[model samples]
Target: MNDEHDSAFDSVTSWIVAALGLLVLVLVWGVIFTFTVYSQALGDAFGLSSLRLSSIFSITTAAFYIAGGTIGILIARVPLRPVVATAGAVFGVAIGLLQISSSYLGLAVVFGLLGTAGGTMFVIVISLVPQWFEQYEGRAMGITMAGNGLGIFVLPPVWVWLLERTGIREAFVVVGGATVLVILVAAVVYRRPPELRAQGTAPVDVAWLRSNLTDGRFVSSLVGFALLWSWYFLLSADLVGILTTGGISRAVAATAFGIVGGVSVVARVASGEFADRIGMRVTLAVGTLLAAVGMVVLPWTGTEPLMYVLLVTFGIGLGAIAPLFSPIIIERFGPANATAIVGVFTVAEAATAFLVPIGLNLLLGVTNGYVVPLLTVGGLTLLGAGLFYRGTAPKTSPQL
Candidate 1:
């Protein structure tokens, strides 16, 4: 491990670079989260069923998470600048292509590309956090991840306004151009700590990763995390639809969804501070329980005030989980293999993301209401909380 007293640790340049990386995440995810706003527009334009439209998001989300596994390995080997710049460029192109997409297949293809780019960008930026800070790792991670919540909070409403003024195609063009510029600039500013750069890329220890994977506690933790993420993916993808179907105006629904983003910003940073004090396991369990409560109450929230309350409660849980991902992995496995370990965890999440949205959409088709599906998700979230609580047993292996 790098010495705590190294100049890079909590240095001004380090924080500046971290902030730029945070902005990169904001730009990348800002575009992706706008899907909630765009779904209605695209559905009307293409005359597509909800199931079909959801498939695009499901596929993209799955790709995004699954790509993390491979991208994590690449980040370990390659320089950060080229990898990030290329990912930004690819993501920009994919968004630009959305302007010309006339068919479902084309949209799906471009979205998948966008997903891959998002996954690459996310893993690279997040993995760098531990290398830069030792004493305040959790706080740094929390601040960085708050950008995700910030993006989700800020982007959807703007996208809705842009959609109204410029139409969907033109909005895509504008968002795509802006995303490319922001990402490239951020990429230039991101740098590995001097200590890490001096050491060069350490070869990944396959045996270590394999052994960790086989640990019962580690496996359980991954499963529990995946279940919690299943609820997140579904809620993020369907929140707008659920509200609109219940007779809320589109503008109001978008604002309500933005509230989730807004609440998440606070939840993420606060949870990180809490985790640094209490422990990741306890923090995770608390967050998951809150999420379960929010999900269970969501279906009954018919009035606007009740809906906002549920969104705030749910958002706290949603935001809390993001910063915890790296801390949990680093706590268990150490920073040497943090990216790869988190990548494996994300692959599990990808599997859940692949299945949950489609299953929820199908359930909605059969039942014609969200009650059953929401309840099931809530129940699963509770189960995840229990598993996570149980899985944080004493570590059996030495840190690599």
Candidate 2:
């Protein structure tokens, strides 16, 4: 097994396949995250209120996060290739279903399916990277997770061009078909880590999960993750609105938001390497602190230049979180249960995704200004960073 692991580590084929997996994740999440751009068009077509439109988006994101737990369970009991391929197919089909959706309810169902498929693929692919590289796990996961930032940056413009040229329904069909084709082909290239091939059937460890749930460190990490993730989702959903409300022009606000995405691409890769060298805990704390600072200064930025500075700060910090999750879990719990633990963590993230935006909206209503809410979120992010720092501290001794 050691020899097999060595052979697979940094092998040419494994690296190429890992790159393809990154591409797959990019395409999958690119489509999902672009929902922010599409929501307006969807609202116009369906005569939906902003609240209803937001609810639809929330449903998809929540579904994606919640599905991670079930995906973890399935992957533990089944082979990787079949499960991943099936998820890709389902995702492709779900995207296609969006083309013919006539009612808001119908679209919600399709998006829900799409979210589930995307979530399952995300869990499997992230888990697979650790198995492929021993020394470069953080770097590999960083490269792979960078896809999320890339998708957020790249997809909106592409979708906008498509929507302008092809119109909404036609754009859906064309993009859906193309995405499906790529997913099916990528599925063939994805292979399990060589180390796991000899282990005939992976067993589901229910007791391990129960004990982990009871662990103080794990629970603290989960809460911290939830807080940071909530901040991420809230920023994504409301940044443009926040900027526009603060008297920034729409075009400038949108470009500033785009800069966040662009800066994040660099931030993700750089932080990954840094994590590998220094440590994930230190990297994550620094990133979260940057995000907190950005959030605190966000509402006060009065010019485009200041906005860019704020966003770049926040984006770099936000970008670091995704790549760190798998590595941190593996370090804390061991590889055997990393996927399961991540699944539970993802579900907590999903719950935060659902509640944060709504809670912020209510906060804004009560305060009649963005300052208080932004400050509140920023404070929570800092608190999360502190909790994570505490949770990851070296254990002093056996408690019992």
Candidate 3:
């Protein structure tokens, strides 16, 4: 009877955590990605140049990945609730600081703090969800991570509406305050899974990270995933340009980009379910191949229909990648190592996000065409698939 009751309780709370996790991601990613809207508003209000405004966003992005990884490693001993609550506090304080300070330097500093908080909170919630379920872990993670795409889709327009009515400062204050309240409330209600309640939390030590990094399998997997995933950043930065260069109208090109974001939301959910059935490696491999093929065909697209098909294919691959990240790490390294591995892996991803697009743009400038850059990205993604497959083959040793 007690076992039955506990099982029922676990089922109930698992879904609750999943729902709240989704909400948190939506708000967090929404705020992070919507900086473009805020950038335009800030420029008009402060007379800041594009470079200065861009530097602020770049600072925030860098801090998010770097600080998140570093702090995640150090905080492996801490419990979940406090880490989450701290993120809430940091968000509230950062936005409050931004409200009162008008200087560019002040804004940059506050934004970096915000990014750090965002990164910490994101990893904590991601780590939290998988702890609750052994069976439907993929589905729960998918539901939570779908918020990433959903936020990108839903929040920008909402922010644009808010900015028009409330002004930039007032708008941030409102949203930031609401975010704080929701996160703190979530922290209050969140609990560790009953199965894990008696076990000591595993510490992610320097030796462990070193062992994992040096392993051939681990190194290959990281490099392969990063290379394949580079397409996401590459296309996000240049997709419209690629379309326009092929004689598509600017409006149509934008529609193609929007399709990627919209399709990704559904793909995230679908991919999670798919991963649960066939296995993470196969799902990931298939997604990479689909995206690679799309990129390989990108330069030749002439009509709007073809553009949509290519973007949709790429979007599915991109969407599948996000939800699998935590699960894949957990499967290979164990749940104890998931947070730290995710943190470090995220840093690699951030580097690709920052550097790959710049390289693509340089190639575009040099060759004066999209075909070479597009094909190069596709080729790299295919190589990534090959490496990731070999690296993730089932192993007996419990190393990284």
- The top-ranked prediction according to lDDT is 3
| 321-365: candidate 1 lDDT, tens digit per residue | 778766666666556655676677777877787788888989999
lDDT of each: 0.76, 0.75, 0.80
Top of the candidates by TM-score: 3
Regions of model 1 farther than 4 Å from truth: 1-7, 39-55, 95-106, 160-170, 197-209, 237-255, 296-306, 358-375, 389-400
Q: How do the residues 32-104 of candidate 3 rate in per-residue lDDT, one tens digit apiece? A: 8778767888777667799999888889888888898677777666777788888889999898888788788
Tens digit per residue, CA lDDT, model 2, 217-292:
8777778888876567778778888888877898888776677777877887888899889988889889998888
Clashing residue pairs in candidate 1, if any?
none
Stretches of candidate 2 above 4 Å error?
Answer: 1-7, 40-53, 197-206, 245-247, 393-400
